[model samples]
Target: MNYQALFEQIKKKKSFLCVGLDSDMKKIPTHLLSSTDPVFEFNKAIVDATADYTVAYKPNVAFYECRGAVGWRSLEKTVIYIKDNYPDIFLIADAKRGDIGNTSKMYASAFLENMPFDSITVAPYMGEDSVTPFLEYDNKWVILLALTSNKGAFDFQFFEENNKKMFEKVLEKSQEWGTKENMMYVVGATKAEMLSDIRKIAPDHFLLVPGVGAQGGSLKEVAKYGMNQSCGLLVNSSRGIIFADTSDQFAIIAQIKAKELQKEMENLLIEYSIL
Candidate 1:
């Protein structure tokens, strides 16, 4: 999906919530395990329940990859289901992949072509060569890891080189690889204070923020500092929404959680005069 389409969805739904389908097989309702594909079943229910309140769906690849071939198949079915059913919602493959140039191209093709994801999260530690390959695909996005919310982020992302934070340099240098249309950065909501600096470097690009809810990041603070003219933020809530309940009514509970976030986001959009 293009940036305009994304912004329109945000405005239309009064939301910028991206529901993370980080569905774990072990964590899903016990009854779902009886289905032919429990993971896909869980995802389908969550997607159906929360689709109205969210603008995007992100499935963290690790959850599926850990299950091996069956996991991958579940991911494929999940993406296909989303495309066929909810064509307008943006799909992100939360793979966080980055490698040598050739390998990166293959990874890009695998996710953007074969699996048909609208975007994929990418690690930027390897530099431009690792990321440019993903940008080769049209109307697809590369969400580069920037200032993450993890405790270890300070171990390296904040390290200074010539007085500039490492992640700041990553944002500045990555602009050469792709335009705002096809490139976004992952700014963890837990690190909301750093968003001002992030905006200075990436004023027009969307940010896939992942540290809200379960990670205890302030949604209001994220909007105050990170939002742009276009309401450029996709705040994700994984565990808080998807795992809202472990019962058979989990999906319904997930929708309630997502709706709460969407309502808050709508208020933020109105406050910023973006909607």
Candidate 2:
């Protein structure tokens, strides 16, 4: 989906929430295990329940890929199910892939071309060639990892040289390769305070922010600094929403959790005059 289409969904749903499908086989409800594909079934239920309150869904690839061929099948089924049922919802393959140009092309084809994801999270460590391949697709996005929320992020992301932090250089240099239309940055919600500086650099680009609920990132702080004229944020919550309850009522609980965030987002949008 294009940027306008994404904002349209946010407007229609009164949310910029992106439900993360970090479904782990061992973590799903015992009831779902009887199903042929527990992970996909768990995802389908979550999607159906929370689709109304979310604008995007991100399926973290590691959760599926770890299970090998069967896991891959479940991932594919989950993707098809969402596209076939909720075509308007943006889908992201959270693969965090970045490799040589040739390898990146294959990864792009796998997710963006063959699987029909609207975007894929990518690591920018390998530089332009590793990222540009994914940007080749029209209306698709490359969500390059920037200042992540993890404690380890400080190990290198904050590295300074010539008065510029490593992530700052990433924010500036990447703009030369992809426009705001086909590119975004993965700015962790835990780093909300730094958002003001990030916005000064990439004012219009959307940010796929993780670390909100489970990671203790404040939603209000994210909006205060990161929000733009279009409410440029896709704040995600995985365990806090999807795994909130592991009983038969998991989906219902997921819906409730999603709605709580959506309502908060609606208020923020209005406060920021994006509504």
Query: Which has the greatest lDDT?
Result: 2
Runs in model 2 lying further than 4 Å from the true structure: none
Q: How far off is model 2, as Cα RMSD? A: 0.6
In model 2, the Cα lDDT at residue 127 comes to: 99
What TM-scores do the predictions have? 0.99, 0.99
- The models' CA-based lDDT, in order, is 0.94, 0.96
Q: In the order shown, what is each candidate's alpha-carbon RMSD?
A: 0.7, 0.6
Q: Tens digits of per-residue lDDT for model 2 on 1-275?
A: 99999999899999999999999999999999998999999999999999999999999999999999999999999999999999999999999999999999999999999997999999989999999999999999999999999999999999999989999999999999998899999999888999999999999999999999989899999999999998989999999999999999999999999999999999999999999
Candidate 1 off by > 4 Å:
none
Query: Worst ten-residue run, lDDT, model 2?
Result: 182-191
lDDT value, residue 25 of candidate 2: 92
lDDT of 1 by residue, 83-177 (tens): 99999999999999999999999999999999979999999999989999999988999999998889999899989988899999989999989
